[model samples]
Target: MTARLDSVEPAVRDPIRIDFEGWSIEARAGETVAATLTAHGIRGLRATRTGADRGVFCGMGVCQDCLVEVDGVPNQRACMTSIDRPLRVRRQRHGQALAAEVTALPPATAESLRTERPDVLVIGAGPGGLSAAIAARRAGAAVVVVDERRYPGGQYFKPLAVDGEDVAPPDAQHREGLALVRRALEAGVEIRTGVMVWGAFAPAEFTASDDRGAVRYLPKAAIVATGAYERGWPVPGWQLPGVMTTGAAQTLWRTARRLPGRRVLIAGNGPLNLQLAAELLAGGAEVAAVVESARPGARHLGALVAMAAAAPSLVRDGIRYHWQRMTRGVPMIDGMVVAAIERTAEGLAVTLKNASENGGHRRFEVDALCIGYGFEPSNELLRALGCRHDFDAEQNRLVTRRDGDGRTSVAGVYALGDCTAMGGARVAAADGAVAGYAAAAELGLPLAPALEREREAAKKQGDRHRRFQRALWTLYRAPPYRIEQASDDTIICRCEEVCFGDARAALAEGVIAAGPLKRATRIGMGPCQGRYCRPLLEALLAQGSDRQPDEHSGFAPRVPVKPIAIRDLASASD
Candidate 1:
């Protein structure tokens, strides 16, 4: 029921048949293995070591939950691996040994490493990273932007279809990204999409890899705008197939034009859930219910006024989303949260409990469950590069300590977008431009007076968006996060399958910080590098200690923040 609003309906071009689990499935060129599987109702992609069913939880490459076997190569992330030809994809099961398979694989080669010297290195192709690159390039710096995503727009500016070359962008976000990316390219910015920036040794020393091999970047200055991932809530059966973050569902729908299921139950805190619900409904998917943790009402009139003042179009968009929900007869279950989820023959049986004044529980049998509880910044590279950070008690996450112009504590290094703070795309774009101009000025690059004037405008735009973000959150404010509500048996780490009880026992044994607790219980030892569980672990610690976790409570940023092939890592050595 979920697909692009293009010729995808009638038929597609250059289609290929994939032998997935002995069933021949139709797929499109450039379509992700995850999308191809889900389009035909193939949910259970793999099994956890504990025999628990898993699917596309994070959607992006952050979570390794969607690993599958691709042509005998076990543990390939279906979401990250795209196929343009015929292939065999198998479900990776529990206790499936890769030792023999590993030996069968090809070895690493030094030729995989390509050294590049650039004036500015932007570690993301998203709004912020592209903006920085564009500005730096225009100011006479040789800029190279690297992003892990196949498309250059990053998550917010995600392209409409996997094979949408003939199709126009479905929305204004993609259009905007297209325009910005075009401007960056015109300004001589070297954008290397499909490249994963894995490690940062020095301020501007970075190692990245692609399908072919690895590349080492030595830039004079660097901007770490790796962006953020969807924050997760650890509910029971959350790891089940068809249960995923709102962003993951959006990615599938937007990029691959595939819905997780025919009917979806969208839940959790923040405006994203609402926006996603509207998008899915527009895409012809039946929304079972929009379970929101917040109850926006007239009591937040001041915030509404500020939001309208800051971004009237966005406010109107929010209204439009609600109007669509109403017109579509979609249930907008506000002041509630997904309490539990269980598998059903038809789909998933979801239980919604009241988190606010709406004191009631509702049940729904839906094909999929989309849960997005805001986001956590992907600041591993920034932190790894020794940029300072602080715990924002209000937001309940760690934020990068940076100047107004995006200057980090380390010289020649910058940060922008939600990676620094969870401001929206508008905020990121505006702030990125300012940082770019600042970087240019610092590098002694010639900045025309017109560009300086535009920089001032960018600063103003950033201010307005910041104000809008504040007011928007106020309008969508939810109750405090209660990690204790999660059952003791709830799995906290999807990678390691560590449960709440395990962490509780570890805390009982005198481990309070993330590092010690991670070792004691092996919680954050997952492939995601604690991007999903770090906040939960800190919350768990706070619940037990009766105090909030400090900035240090999050795991220390390590080398190869994202999972890199051993071959790619070895090739990084000059």
Candidate 2:
């Protein structure tokens, strides 16, 4: 478990008592259930169907690991739900079982659902969505942006605590995100937070719901900037209570001013890991080590030149982060990976394996282990809308297909940001501005002359960001993933707890595609909707043989793309 950092100023001192299990814990007003529990030295919030202890693994609402029964409502995300008053929370063991047979759709009366018509609707409240809304509204189009999070900034710009508005801006990124949010609000962009866009119908019709009620949006144009979630690689005991993605830990510190643990070990294959390590160090955590799979030294000097040339500030930040570890005497274990994690009496024992042929190993005992391999686009909405996509071999994932201005195969639909491709925040913002202008133009909204110039400028800026990302990836090159490296007993499908052996057996049955394999084993039927395992399941197809992704390689997204309450479904209005 973790504790609040004393260095970080308190957001608000108003404390509320929440009864978890039988213990009454004091939590700051407006703090999430996850943060409150963590601050009070409680991490394990639930038990999987198989009775494995689970906690906040993804930190976001995506993973569903932090499901806690809040005031009797089961399956509430601890990280997303705040405690504004005294409450009784419980560690959820299992959900209520559903009936065996399907029945008719629930009746959703018009009076219960709130509906609206807008010139443009933007999904997600990340940089891309906010930029799109600002641009579209500036171009004289009525805009509405919906996000599942409680705040405007996405993962990149994790907002201050809900009651932390009075706190000083922590960094330039925070200031920039706040400025962008302000700009969007000033432009009259209607942003609805804490609302989940659960389903999308044809011709850009969308349905969303929050705690109060559901909303249906009919728009002339809709921009999808749902962004992406980090890819969690499966290893032995990876589903332990204290293990989570690096971003999850970072979000806890950034927004709630709490460390995952006093001692933390981070293992990953991207610059984000380094950024997290640096942030944790600054936030008063004992970073045992940073296990990076990439070797970036003399072998990558050539790539560094191009990176510095393209984005000098970002390169400088990387160098600073690299040095911070050195001066602090934190071991920056290069060319190594986290092979496995096992729970110990105190915390966790992590095994680090070398990426080279020498096969050296190291181990560390820490309170938390953070794993962040890479990312996969959160494309459920895009897929449910029937937008076209293509498999990107470099990233080893299916990326949504979009044109220069983020237009998709569907006439009125658009996608951008990490959802369409793995471009960083600036790249996504630039792309979003261009898409917003394009959508406004199509809607016959009054276009400003300044917008055309800004759009062109954004295009050029995006080109630079892309070049920098390419160079950055080159500098931090990762070895190809081989599922054979993992133990046969390692759980592949985290939600279902399906093992690698189980998948191999299904493969032996001649099930090569995603759909049949999903049926053969209940792999993709879990709450995460296979976000953690589907790619790895697909990777099983090319385990030894170099198989490629066919048109049917990926799983199809159905309605209620994300799990939503049936009550919410029955009460939606437009």
Candidate 3:
């Protein structure tokens, strides 16, 4: 049975009935299919080939496990597909759909696949892109901002479904992001939502597509602020239906205004975990515990002091979060790491190891497990554009190389937000403003004295945030590599159903890099296109074989960054 709180409010009043496996569920208009189903006690949306149930893992389109047959269209992302009308949604049984399953979409005409040219093309509508667009417009440049989501806030200030219910952000961070959106619109930024940028090509070209058709964007200068996705770490039984990333659970609460579960266990290393705990508690969910993998010690003192000095606001925010947890009597256990998750008849049995106590074990039974290790920059689009990459050893990821002003190695291309560096939204916005200012200045838009002052201030703020982030990284370092805890039966790639044993055997057979391993086991070639499994697989390969991540820098991403329907591609040809 699914646990839902009575405190939750639907985004729409007049209900649109959606059929899920023959069960009629009342869904709101602005809510996604996943939100609608999960709210109605339907978490298991699909079954894997191994017959294990899968639910909303990432709550975004990155993890394709939420694919459901929507109105006869198989493999449609339930989270990205909003419920505008009554529809028939069915559980995709082991990737199978009925023979009669078909949805006829109108063919795309030349006019539909319209091409536009702007002075500046911003690839994301989040804080970064919005700030960039606003600055460019201030400098008398025609700016266009594109985002895949139907809304303008991106992930940081993602507003709750505002079509039916008035859901305001409960926190100041997100509130500020909403305010940025307003400023950008008032500054005459052309914000295009529901457009997916699939590829970036030579001479500043971007190929994007939406339901209407494919669109091409050519711009004098471009800013890539595509943002980042949640990083997944391997633990036994992590593939369970109820186990999801903290980002996923946060989306359920923040964007959808729905609780993930009645009893939730949040484990990982970061401020995001603490913030999630507070949100879950406010949403009336029972937070069992917040198990932090990093142990706070004397070693963290220097970094903490440095961080506090660099960003006092961040320090104050941290103290407030601590106070919230303490006042609510929520146990925030540092020096504890998740060892494994065991399936229980009721929900799940989570085994945690005390890092400070010689790996002593304790078990907690909870209905949901939300894990957040850290974030990896979603830098595929930048890499695709031939942007140089530097391996960030501390983070164990390849981030796109950028100057202080967010200019990439490419002359006309710039990068901001988490794609350039994993600084939070504020840093992204600051860097984006600077990028916009510099780009506009280079494009012959004379920077006013006041604009120059603002740009310098933003640059200074971004630098300070960068220092804070470096200190935070040192203080909250990831736990010692623990891939050994993954049992042989543990599944690594949900899309391909490849287990640890399979990956190990493939590695033993001289599959050293992500590309070879993927070709051998068909691991990253699935619907997600390596978004979910590549990081885990890369780590597994490095740990299994004594090779550095740079030795095999993962599989190179192809065009159509997100999966596009064949019909859409064919329609573009027409």
Candidate 4:
């Protein structure tokens, strides 16, 4: 069993008791139902179809692994739902809600759906969307900002739990994000939180839902800053209870104010892993080790030199992170990858193998494993809107077409932030400012001279950030052979329980692309809508056939980017 920190106090003064799987537990007000469960070391929130225990893998609403039946509603995202009153909660199995008390409980009627006709609608509340909304509002355009998370911060600026001690220390990036959000609100931007945007009709029409039923926003322009999700890689035992993505682990500490486990292993191929190690150390969790698949060599030298001359602050930040890890006695191992994982008698056992040399492996035992190779932009909304996109080979992803000012292929639509490419916070903010100014100007709002100057300056700053992004991609790019490390028996898609062996067999039987492979082996047909497995599976198929990722094509996403309550859909009006 996992242990939780009893020393830390709950954020709320007033608390309520709730029933969890027949066991009553104390929960604080303003705490997410998911956080309440984690604080008590309840990891197995649900069980899969194969009888495997599943818990909070992404913590965010993106991964449906944390679904729980709340008040008789089936398939509710526990991480997004807050505890307002005494509620009956039960663990879900497959798609079944197992609460015995739920006998013909009717859906709670919500208030009339709020409709808005803002001049400009910002799709995300992170640095990008906030900056865009601020700029647009300053130029006299009525603006509204919407985000899926309850908080205003996007992933990078995600707000920490309200604890006595600061969950996150004073950082420039966090400060900037907060300042942007404040300025946008002061500038009269209407901010909507905890809204899930399901569908987008071209030319600025969106169908979304919140606790208040369904809402539609008919804006003259829209800016998409919906950011990216942590990329998932397949390996044996990845479906186990203790396994989670790197972002999920960070969310555990940052949002829930609790460590994921007593002992944890961090593995991935990016700078985020280094930062996560430092974070874990601060959160009072034992860092077993950090395994980095990318090896530092001459290829990264040019990018490093360019960044040093262009953005010394970014370079210094990286140095300071490593220094913190070194002082804490955390081992930073490079040129290594997680070859396989399995549940042992003690806990989760991970096999670390050399990325450069085959047949070399080392074993480590830990209670939890946090793994992420990189990030894939949440481009489903843009794709579903029919925005033109082309593949970027070096980045190993597809980016929505946008000019320097965040204009997309479709008119009245703009794409910004990491979704455009992983350019971090500063770059996203700069680009967002430019987009906001340009959008306002296009909408017939007269921009002041100072705002115009700021727009130009923002463009120049965005260039520097883009340079840093280029260096970042060059420095920690995933090796081609890393995907080949998955054993034949490894489960690739946890949603459908599709194994790597079955996918390989389908490829061997002349399945050339993702479309054919899906039909042959049911790879991408699952509850997650291929959010977790499609990218890795597509890469594997491409590598097996020696074709590029774009040649294999991408998965077509359907409406409702996230899973919604059936009652909410029924309540939505045309």
Candidate 5:
């Protein structure tokens, strides 16, 4: 029996009685307490540290924007949580409740920041987002830019300290990004650092939560340039503390000035792996070996051609660096893969397997193993919003619809940078500029001819990059051996302590599907909310049960769908 979408109507039922801040309300069953209160016109669910009013911003779970107390727990994101049964809500000022007690600080941390509504809310402050913000502000729209990182640079341009002073240097493509962000800041863009817009919903509401406390923003239009994360191949001991993805290692080194380990083993097939090896070696870390899964002669031939033709200087520099490494006795091993890893007191004992040989392996002592196949779009926010997505089997990511401009299927909501499609920073910054100009035009702002021409040029670059990306995806697709890496004892969901054996048992006992397995074992319902574990679990189940990965396995759908504070729910009916 297939569920008919057209048969369901939007109606409230099975009311649950609750009290919020002295007000009595009847919340329908299966409705979030926040949704019930909002329906009853109850605003100001929680108070700021300065005793100011606040409410939901991002409707999704990531932002932690709609945090409130339900029953007794404090600091829960209201949007991600549901209001089943009965919930008590209370108003918690910045320094009034447990949050205050936890920090035991003056109100300055909570009260000193100014709050204002902007006409345009940009979810990321990357190159594309910054360019869009600057254009909007220049056209007389009050603009606010929010980013999860401490600094404004997306992946392309990073902030560095020179002579003990913070400075931003423009990489090959980030130079233009730096100029755009500087222009926006100069033009009065209200930039919020370390703020993540986790959820966006109808009626123009969004939620954001940070160390400063939860804040909600209402904007006329919003742009999503949230970018992407590195995709790690599933393998044994991947969850080990010393095993990090290439991007994670890069972030640690570049942002925090911390090395993941003294001796590193770089594995995985991609140009990025080579780039990371170079960076790690340059940063004074010992590179034990560079193991590439691809047969270099066959896979990198086209890339070599592209490198020589498009970026000869980069090619020369890469050759020179590799030569220096060889001169220093560093070895680059091809046609090899990391078979497994064992944690030792020293660090990690990694097993290396020859790709061409059967049952051939060697063990190497290493402090860290950095692995990443490539990049994938961060689509958690988009998926939560009911946006249509298709699985790009090659890249292992959800695909979004886009036109010449960066418009997604949802009008007034746009995606740019690697989040839309994977390319390096140069393409991302260029796409950001195009999205900015298009968004500005839609907002009734005039666009300069030169900017329009620049956008046209960017499209050409994007096309070329897309072709290159496609070739890379086909060449370095996850090998069949990856599916066999899951041992029976390998933990599937770290948050819930669910393991491969547990999931298999559930399947054998007629749990049968992903949804049922999740319900029986609570595998995907942990605090991370399945972001980190869902894909891997889905893949494993698909392989084990002979089912499609996208098929509903049997996870229960819960309201607020995320962790929420008990106090805010209690306040709504007070």
Candidate 6:
């Protein structure tokens, strides 16, 4: 028997009500406060002084879009947050005062006494992040750099192994990153790898809990260079174990030195896919196909041409290599999309639908599917701080408005790197340097004319890259048909194992919002959390409930911001 909405009695759930600016909502037991507010049509729970209304975009704790003040704490990600107890909620537009209030009263324990305030706190140890820390320390600021990864490098400088031993190679990008790490350490930058900054509150205090345990960092200013993640795309069999994002696959190969499969099919739109494919092929993996969704004469041709002209050698080499593969009868399917993937006895039989042919389909047997569209800014921490964002419809990114030097709307807070906007690694590092100097200047340090000159150079380089990125984005935009291709049985949220059917059922039960459905279905509460799945879930639920994707309310804000290890907390003195 199917479980009907009314047949299942509403569990005697505790009700937590939040009163926002001119709005009010009640969160059911175990529901996130953000989700609860979103369920009740509170789209603009917070508004900027410019009157720009904002809410959660990425339901994952990564994109900080759904930050709100809970009982005086500013910048808590509403997605990972739950309303376990009664609390006050407010809309914050700027400053860390409200955010600081929340952290001031974090259920204090014995370990809380050890919390040390630094002069400068840097979240994320990527090229930009590490550079910023090193620069700040050299400028006489007491600096502390925290990162979630096991090592210093963020995305650009990934750790790799050689000869059964983990060695930082001098030629590797991460080796460059290692140099920054070493410099920062030598310059007295306290580095804490494997630590995640869960919250950034007012009075320049940030909460980071990791292997050592939860610690409060009270810095004069903060630098956020958290970076970006691969955008999620919906397709059949995407939930399969062997199927992963191109970035994830690269991480596996680069970091763990593990092949995704014996035979791999790389698909999606972007230069990253091609670059990754070439890397995989060079790494001795059989690339069965490189399926791209873009048509040859699509828009953004100007930018593509410019890129080809600028990097003639790279373009020539890429063309030469791909031509060789094609001459050897290797499959390179353009204007095609993966329709379905079925696990066969041998491997994965991927059904290909070619747009050029009517009702035309082809199949390829491969062991893995490496898929990704592009990158999206990971802004959860910033959003939690109540920073404002604008939806860049072209790139499909919710970008925070920042000064020329990467200062966000919030004073004393700065954002740089791919986290601000998806420029490549070079742009990220350059932006980090600019932000570092700008932040120091903001702290009353004299500005060097050379630093301003470097900023101008960085801006020009960034502009060029951004133009190329826009063209690339247009080239690799997810086809409209991909959304229509989702099967009713397809599971969107792998963490909660929630399928399209479950999402529809939630809508039918009057959930009709992203927040409530999350609680009812646990759609965004998994290991990777909603980092990869939130956008898909949002689109699915919006369609199911007959609401525009952007119109849907945001997620609830919660604390203990990042996932903490039980052992780490247990080891901390009470």
Candidate 2 stretches greater than 4 Å from native: 1-13, 95-106, 109-113, 162-169, 356-358, 544-546, 572-574
TM-scores of the candidates in the order shown: 0.93, 0.94, 0.92, 0.90, 0.72, 0.73
Q: Model 6, range 52-89, lDDT digits (tens) per residue?
A: 44454333344344567877656665644555577778
Better of 3 and 6 by TM-score: 3
lDDT of 5 by residue, 197-295 (tens): 555565445665554555567666667777776654555665554666676556444433345577888887766677677767766789898887767
* Candidates ranked, most accurate by TM-score first: 2, 1, 3, 4, 6, 5
Query: Higher-TM-score candidate among 2 and 5?
Result: 2
Candidate 4 residue-pair clash tally: 0
Give per-residue lDDT, candidate 5, residue 156: 50
Q: Across residues 84-123, which tens digit of lDDT does each residue of candidate 1 receive? A: 6899999988676546534455554434567887888888
CA error at residue 36 for candidate 2, angstroms: 1.5
**Alpha-carbon lDDT, every model:** 0.82, 0.83, 0.80, 0.78, 0.60, 0.64
Cα lDDT for residue 277, candidate 5: 76
User: In model 2, what lDDT does residue 528 have?
Assistant: 91
Checking candidate 3 for backbone clashes, the offending pairs are none
Clashing residue pairs for model 4: none
Q: Which candidate model has the greater TM-score, 1 or 3?
A: 1
* Model 2 lDDT tens row, 1-574: 0111221122555768999988998876756899888767687888887888899889988988899888977889999997779989999877566443312346685445677889899998899988888888999999988888877878889876644544334677777877788788777888777889888888688888876767788889999999899888788999999999998998888777778998999999989999999989987889999999999888788788988888899989998998998889998888888878899999999988877543688989999999898898888888888888788899777788888888999988988899888988989998999899989988888677888899889889899999989988998887866677767899988888899999899898898778888999898899899888888887887776878774357677877888887667665421
1 or 5, greater by lDDT: 1
Q: Candidates 1 and 4: which is better by TM-score?
A: 1
User: Which pairs of residues collide in candidate 2?
Assistant: 113-572, 113-573, 115-574
- How far in Å is the alpha carbon of 318 misplaced in model 2? 1.6
Q: Going through the candidates in order, what is the number of backbone clashes in each? A: 0, 3, 0, 0, 53, 22
Say which candidate scores most in lDDT: 2
Deviation from native of the Cα of residue 133 in model 5, angstroms? 3.0
Indicate the TM-score of model 2: 0.94
Give the Cα error of residue 7 in candidate 1, in Å: 19
lDDT of 4 by residue, 1-574 (tens): 0101221123444567889988999876656788788777787887778877887787677778888888877687787777768889988777565354343334432234456788999998888888898899989999988888776778886565444443444346556656666677678888888788888776667888876777778888899999998877677777777778888777766655667787889998888888878778887888999899988778778989988877898799888888988898888888888877888876789998887777679888998899878888888888878788778876778878888788998898988998877788888899999999989998998889999999999999999888887887778866744568677888888778888889889878887677778888888787678887787777776674566665227577677766665556556432
